[model samples]
Target chain A: MRLFHGQRAWVLQRLTALVVLLLLALTAATLLIGPAPSYERWHALATSAPGAVLIVIFFAALCGHAWVGVRDIVLDYIQPTALRLPLLALIAFILIAITLRVTLTMATHFTVGA
Target chain B: MPAPPRAAPKFLNLAQIRFPIGAIASIGHRISGVLLLISLPFLVLALERSLRSEADYAALGTWLNSPWRALLLVVMVWAATHHLLAGVRHMLMDIGIGSRLAQARMSAWSTIVAALLIALLAAMRWLS
Candidate 1:
C-alpha cells in the first residue's frame, strides 16, 4: 500500500525543510552572536509575541517535514501492511501531539509575558 | 549455440558494496532525520522547562551540562549539521545546480566535512 505517495508529499517535505532550515539558522545565529546564553534572554526570546509565533511556525514546519520523512522511511523498510499502518499512525499522533503541545506552551507563555 | 543457465544470487550482500560518497551522504540524511525525530520530544521537553521558570531553566541547563548529555548534544549537533547540509545539497540538485556526478560528489564530501567541523566547534564551545 502507498502510505505517503505522490508529488504533494514530496513538495511538502522540501518546502517544510526550507522553512526549518531558515528558522534554525536564524535561531542559532541569534544564540551564538548575541550576548552570553542566559535563562532571561532565552525566556524573553521565547515569550515575545513575534518570537513565540515564529517558534510555533518553526515547530509546525518541523512536524510536517518529519511526518513526511518518517513516512517515507517506514514505507520503504516495513513490508507488512499490518505493521506499517500502525507505525505511521503512531508517528502521526506523535507529531500532531508535539505540534499542539508546543503551540500551547508558546501561547501560554506569550500571554503571561505580555 | 544456447548459453548455459546459471543460478541467480539468492541474497543481497550489503557488506560487499562500497558506498559512493553521495550515497553515504544520502544515507546520513535519512539516519540523521530519524535521530532528530527520536530526540524531538526530549528537545521539546527542554524547551518547555526552559520557558516554565528561571529555576527550571537553570535546572535544565545544569542537566544539559552534564557529561553524558553533553556527549548526546555533540551527536545531535553533528546530526543536525549533516542533515542541513545534505538537504541543501539535495535541494540544489533538484534545482539542477549540482546534478553532475563530479559536482555532486564534491558537494557530498563538503557537506560531511563542513558538518564535522561545525560540530567540532560546538563541542569545543560547550565542553570547554
Candidate 2:
C-alpha cells in the first residue's frame, strides 16, 4: 500500500502558505497602524465580518500548512513507521483541536453581541 | 547465488561537516517550523483569553507587558518571521525561481536578514 504520496500535500502546503502569507501581512499592517492591543480593539476586529472570515481562513490554512510541514519532518527523522504514524496522528489531533477552539470562540463571541 | 555483503564504512562526525549559509537557512526553516508548532498552544490560549472577557483581555495585556513575556514574544516573532521568509524562498524555488546555487544562497541570506529585521521591529514595538 502506498502510504505516503505527498504530491497533493505538497501543493496544498504551498497554496495554504500563500494564503497565510497574505493574511499575516494584513494582520501585521493592522496591528501596526490600528489601535493598540486592547480588549475593545480586539473585540471590534474579531467581531467584524471580514476579520472573522479572515481569522477562520487563516486558522484553517495554518492547520493544513503545519500538518504538511510537521509530517515531512517526522517522515525524515523518525525511522520507525509505528512511532511516526502515531506521532503524525497526534499532531493532526492537536491542530484540529486548536482550529475548533479558535473557530468556536470567534463564532460565539461575534454572534453574541451582533 | 547470494549477493556479496556490503562493508560498513567509518561514521563521519557531525562536527566535521561544513554547513553553508543556504543549508543553515534550510535547517533554520525546519527549526522555526518546530518552534512555531510548539508555541501554537500558547498563542491559541492567548487568543482565547483575549476574547473571553474584558478582564481576561486586561490580564493578557498585563502578562504581555512583563519582561518574560517580552522575551517569549521576541523568540516567537523571530521564529515566525524566519519561517515566513524561508517559506517564501521555498515557494519561489518551487516555481523554478532562485534554483541556482548562488541565487539560492543569496535568497537564504536575505531571508535571515529580513527575519532579523522584522523581529527587531517587533521587539521595539513590544518593549515601547
Candidate 3:
C-alpha cells in the first residue's frame, strides 16, 4: 500500500488518528477508575501482556499520524525542494527510530518480566 | 503567440491579514500537531524511564515535577488537548456534521475553548 502518498496518506492519517483517540480514552478511563498512580502499578501495567501490546499499538498509531500531519505542514510551508526533502527525511528517520525504541523497550520489559 | 495570464497580486503581510475564527482553529491544529510531533521523543523517553525500574520511575516523576519541566509539561498538555479536540472537529466535519459556516465557527470556538479549559485543569492538577 502506498502508505505515504496521495489518498493513502490521507486515509492512513484519519485511521491512525481514530486509533490514537480510542487508546487515549481507554487510558484515561483506566487511570480514572483504577488505583492511584504509583511506580509499582505503573511498572506492572507496562509489563503486562495486554498493556504492553496496547501501548505498542498506541505509539505506532501516534507516530504514523504524526508522520502524515508533519508531512502536510512541511509541504505547505517549505517550498524549496532541497531544504524540504532533507527535512522530511530527517523527520521520517527520527519517527522511525522512536517507534523502534518504544517497541524495543516494551519487548525487553515484557520478556524480562516473563 | 497569446499573452500569458498575469499572476494575481499577493497580499503577503502576515500581521495585517486577519484570520477568521475557523481559520484560527485550523492553524491551531497545524501548530499543535507540530508541537506534539516534536515532543514525541520526550514522551517515549518518559515511557522508557518510567518502565525501567521503580527507582527510575520515581526519578522520572521527580524530574518532571521540576519547575521548568512542569511548565514544559503544561505546554505539551495544551498541544495535546488542542490537537485532539480540533481533530475531533475535523472528523465530525468529515462526517457532514457542523460543516455549515455558522456551525463550523461555533465548533471551532468550542474546540479552542475546551482545549484551553482542559489545559488549565491539567495545570491545576499538576500544581496541586
Candidate 4:
C-alpha cells in the first residue's frame, strides 16, 4: 500500500491557491484604490469586521499555500531523509509562528476601540 | 549472455541548457514562492510595526526611504506580481483552460509581460 498519495495534496493546494488569489486581489485593491497608507486609514480598515475577516482568511490561506509549495520543493531537492525532515519541520514552525503572530496581533490590536 | 555495458553517466550543464518560456515561468513561480516565504517574517514585522501607532508607521515609512529597503521592496513587488500571474496560469491549466502547448506558451509569455508591467508600476508608485 502506498503511504502517501499526492492527489489530495494537489487538490488542496489548488483550493488554497484560489483562496489566496481572491484575497490577494482584494488586498491589492484595498491598498491601491483606497487612501494612501496612513495609520488612521489602515487602522480603520483593520479594525472593521469585514477587513479583519478578510485579513484572517488571507493569512490562513497564504500559510497553507506556501506550506504545500515549499514542501514540494524541499522533497524534490533534499535527498537525505534526516536533513529533509528537519528542514521541513523548521519551515513549518516558521510558517506557524507567522500565522499565529498575525492572528494574535489582529485580534488584540484591532479590537473594538482600544 | 554477457552483462550489458553500464550506461555512461550524463552530467547536466546548467549554463548550456536553454529553458523555454513556459519552463522559465514555472521556475519563476517556485523562485518567487521561496522568496515570499523567506520574506514573510520581515513583511510581518513591518505590518506589525506600522499598525502599532502613528509614530511607528511614520518610522516604517522612513525606513522605506533607504535605497536598500527601496530595492528590496521592488524585488518583492516583482516577486508578488510574477507569482500572481504564474499562479493564475497554473490554475487555468488545472481547469483545462490553457493546457494546450500553444496556449500554455502564450500564457507563460503573458505572465512575464504582465508581471513586469505591474512591478514597474508598483516600483514607480513606491519610489516616487
Candidate 5:
C-alpha cells in the first residue's frame, strides 16, 4: 500500500507508544509487587536477560517517540526559525543523552559485576 | 414575499459548538510524552536512592512527600492518563470502528470525557 511519510511516522509512533505503555505498566508492577530490593538485587534484575531487554526497548521507543512528538510541538508553537530549530536540536540531544547515560551505566554495572 | 428564502446558515454557535478534538488530543498526547521524558531522570534518581539502603529509602520517601514531588507526580499522572485516553481513540480509528462523521464526533467526545475523568482521578490520588 502507498503510505505517506506522515503515515509511516504515525505508525512508528503508535507502535512505540504501545511498547512504552506495556513497559511502564510492567515496571510499575515490578516495583510495587515486591519489597524494594538492595542495590545488588536491583542490579541483577536490571542486567538480567529480561530486565535488560525491557529497559533497552523501553528507552529506545521512549526516546524516539518523545523526540518526534516534542519536535512537532516546538515547531507548532514556536514560530521563530532559528529558535525553533535550536530547541528541536536540544530535544534531540536530551534524548541521546538519556539513552547514552542509562545504557553506559547499565553496561558498566553489568560487565564489572557479572 | 420580501425576498427569495435564504439558505440556512451553517453555524449555530461556531465558537461553542465546533471543537477540534483530534488536535486537542494530539497536543495533550505530545505534552504528556514530553513531561514524562523530562521528569524521568529525577524518578530514576529516586529509585537509585531507594535501592541504596533502608535509610536512603526512608530519605527518598521524605523527599517524595514534599510539595515539589507531589506536584511532579500530579503532572506525571496527568500526562499518563491523557496519553492513555487518546491512545484508545487512535486504536478505534485504526480498526475502522469510528470512521463515520457521527461516530467520529462521538469518539472525540469520548476522548474528552476520558481525559477529564483521568485528570480528576489523578488529582484525587495526588491530593490524598
Candidate 6:
C-alpha cells in the first residue's frame, strides 16, 4: 500500500504539514531555552542556511495551506461557484506574491552591501 | 378547500439531525476557523512580547498557562485538528481510499476521534 492517501495535493499538504511541525518544534525549543540572544547572534542564526531553508519552506507551506483553507471557505459559503473560483484565484495570487516578497527579503541578508 | 398554505418551517433540515457526521465536521471546521480568527490577536501579542525581553518572555510563559490562555489554547487545538482532519479527508478522496459510503463514514469517525484525542491532550497540558 502507498504510504499515504496517494493524492498529489493531499500528499503535498501533509508534507508541508510535517515541515511546519518540525519548524514549529525548533521554534518552541529555541524560545523555551532563552529569548536573550544578542542582535548579532539572532542575525547570524537567521542568515544561516538551515534557518533560511526553514523559513522559506515555512512561508511556502503556510501560504499554500492558508490558500487551500480560504478556498474551501469560499466554496462552502459563497453560494456561487463562479464567484468562488475567482475569489480563490485572487487569494492565491495575493498569497503567492506576499510569500515571494518575504522570501526575497530573507535573501537580502547574505548579500554584500549595495 | 381549493388550496391551503401553511407557514414554512422555521428551521433547516440541517438543524434536524438524523445522521450528522458530515455536518458535524463542517461545523467543527467552521468553528475552528472562527476560534482561530478570534485568538489570532492574543497569540500575536504573546509573540510580540516574547521577542521583546526576558521579562516579557517570562510574562508570556505565565500568560500561556493562565485560565484564559488555556481556553484560547483549546481553541487553537481544535482549529489545528479540524483543519488537519479536513486535509486528510481531501487526501483520502484523492487516493480513492474511502469513496464507498461505509468507508467514508469510517473515515469521518476516525477524524473526530483523532481530533478529540488531540484536544484532550492539549487541554490537559494547558491545565497542568
What are the lDDT scores of the predictions, listed in order?
Answer: 0.89, 0.86, 0.87, 0.84, 0.71, 0.66
- Give residue B98's error in model 3 in angstroms: 1.1
TM-score of chain A of 1: 0.89
Which DockQ-derived CAPRI band holds candidate 4? Answer: high
How many pairs of residues collide in model 4?
A: 0
Which lDDT tens digits does candidate 2 get at residues B1-128?
A: 77556874777887899989998898889999999989987887887787778999888767867877897888888999899889989888988999899999899999999898888998888877
After superposing candidate 1, which stretches have Cα over 4 Å from the reference?
A: A1-3, B1-11
Q: List the residue pairs that clash in candidate 1.
A: none
Q: Which ten residues in a row have the lowest lDDT in candidate 2 chain A?
A: A105-114
Clashes of each: 0, 0, 0, 0, 0, 0
Q: What residue pairs clash in candidate 2, if any at all?
A: none
Span of ten consecutive residues with least summed lDDT in model 1 chain A: A105-114
The C-alpha stretches of model 5 lying farther than 4 A from their native spots are A1-8, A28-44, A111-114, B1-20, B50-54
| lDDT of the structure predicted as candidate 1 | 0.89
Docking class of 6: incorrect
- Give chain B TM-scores in order: 0.87, 0.85, 0.87, 0.86, 0.66, 0.75
The docking category that best describes candidate 3 is high
TM-score, candidate 3, is 0.90
Model 3 over residues B1-128: C-alpha lDDT tens digits? 87657975777998899889999999999989989988889889889888877898778767767777787788888889899999999999999999999999999999999888888987887766
lDDT per residue (tens digit) for residues B1-128 in model 1: 77556874556787888889998898899999999999999989988888878899789767767877888898999999999989999999999998999999999999999989998998997788
Q: Candidate 1: deviation at residue B114, Å?
A: 1.6
lDDT tens per residue, model 3, A50-74: 8899899999999899989989988
Model 5 chain A poorest 10 in a row by lDDT: A105-114
DockQ, cand. 3:
0.86
lDDT of 5 at B112: 68
Model 4 DockQ, alpha carbons vs. true complex: 0.84
Q: How do all models score by TM-score? A: 0.90, 0.88, 0.90, 0.89, 0.73, 0.60
lDDT tens digits by residue: candidate 1, A1-114: 854569999999999999998888898898878665788788888788888998899989999999999988987899999999988999999999999999998888885444
- Judged by lDDT against the true structure, how good is candidate 5? 0.71
